[model samples]
Target: MKKPSRDFWKDSAFALASVALAFAYGSLTWKRDLPNLFRIRAGRPLAEQAQEPNPSLKFTGARGRPLRPFLFTGRTFDVFYFDHVNQPTAEFARATLQATSFTYATLPFANFNQADFRGSYFERASLRGADLRASHFAFTNIIQSDLTGADLRDADLTSARILLTKLEGALFNENTKLPFSEAEAIARGMKRAK
Candidate 1:
């Protein structure tokens, strides 16, 4: 057989590779999850990725509260106190977390549907893919929380302190109340709010 040019093979290989990676994100599993995204985008410089490597937060203290699938809808939690959680499960979902300090706790994919989060300190907490619809975040401190893919549709985020946090793929509808600058900053991490 006659020899085909090397460039032809190279072009064919490149085309195949592009097609494979085109829908790559569809099946790709991002470790940043919902909450870690916050840390990735805002916590460190966007140019540097390998050094940070999805920073993991260590647990300081955790009060042995009952572990069950907690749910909160149409309720008010004020002046409540809870210790630092090493790692909280879905049990604490939607529970009135008023004045609660959940520093560095990984609650990825937890359900916080319609929960009241007034004065809650979720600094450096991971909440990727967590259901936060209709939740209250008035005066909450979500600084450095990983909110990569958390659903914030109709969720309140007025006056929340978020310095270095990832907000990629997070759902924030019109009803969501966040500082205009912060929203713009967060939109950069996700797929253009689409």
Candidate 2:
């Protein structure tokens, strides 16, 4: 049998090395970018992924409907229905949210400073640790909502109802207006502070 040429041996070794290099590069790229790829597919930027809640977990509404997207900023909401939707759940300092129904919506730690919420409804909504200072809640229905650890200084709650709402540990000042009397407000857990 004829011996293989030296050039053939060299060509085979070079091909083997190329294949190994290609495999290593492909694997490293995939491993490093897999999470980012999934985040992009879900239509969320990578920087915001860590800040938002886990997308795999879902929220079900009172009527068994899938939760809708009620999380936004600096935008107007007309007759909007805010249920248990959760995502980007904060930092709406200058928004104009006018929801018709905010029943059972969980908006904890949101920044609503200088925002306007006229003619909105927030029945049974959870707004713990929110910042509503210098904001407006005129003619809003905030019945049975949880406002624990919330800041309401300089806020206008005129004509806003807070029947059965939780305001324990919440901060309010003389500038914060409530439809109820001062005694009634304190009786319902709303506090006066500086």
Candidate 3:
């Protein structure tokens, strides 16, 4: 058998060292550097890409299912339908979630304090035990949605269309503004918060 040349061993060592260095670098900067790679388009540098208005990123969920992309603006979600999505205990305090749909979505124990939900739809959505303190629900539809044990202190629901919504044990303070009178709200199973 013929013996291998000295240059062959040198080349093999160089290739192995290069791969190891690349892997180490990638592991250290994956979070910051890897996202920039995705932003680049058509051989253009990342700097050339226009800065997005919102820092929040858009992502797709549920592979192999007919689901739309979930776009976020800070803590806000504009004009998106989150039907059948299960996101319990989610935090969205002081968010501006305008014109969104939460049909059949499970959002129990979610924190939506002071959120603006104007013109949103909440059909059959589970918002049990949610913190909706000071939230705005103007012109929104709350059909068949569950608000059991939710906090509605200082919340505004003027002109909100509520139909068959469950408000058993939900808390509402004196500062809470509703579409109906306090007596009517109490008749609908909403409790006054201490």
TM-score of each: 0.55, 0.60, 0.64
Which one wins on lDDT?
Answer: 3
Which one is best on TM-score?
3
Q: Provide the clashing-pair count of each candidate structure.
A: 11, 0, 0
Looking at candidate 1, the ten consecutive residues that score lowest on lDDT are: 41-50
| Candidate 2 residue pairs that clash | none
lDDT of 2: 0.69
Summarize candidate 3's per-residue lDDT along 1-194 as a digit string, tens digits.
Answer: 98889999999999999999999999997755554456311322222221335433322122223322222223666664555656667677888878877777777888898899999999999999999999999999999999999999999988899899999999998899888899998998899988
Candidate 1 local lDDT, 1-194, one digit each (tens): 98989999999999999888865753464433433333322222212321333324211223333333333344344443232333344544456767656666676777788788887887778888888888888878878778888888878887777667788888776677775555484555642334
User: Model 1 Cα RMSD, Å?
Assistant: 18.3
TM-score (C-alpha, index-matched) for candidate 2: 0.60
**lDDT scores in order:** 0.61, 0.69, 0.74
lDDT by residue (1-194, candidate 2, tens digit) is 99999999999999999999998998977633553444222223323432445433112233423333434567554554545544334666777776445677777888898888888888888889888899899889888888998989989988787678888877888888877677877776777895
Order the numbered candidates by lDDT, best leading.
3, 2, 1
**Best to worst by TM-score, what's the order?**
3, 2, 1
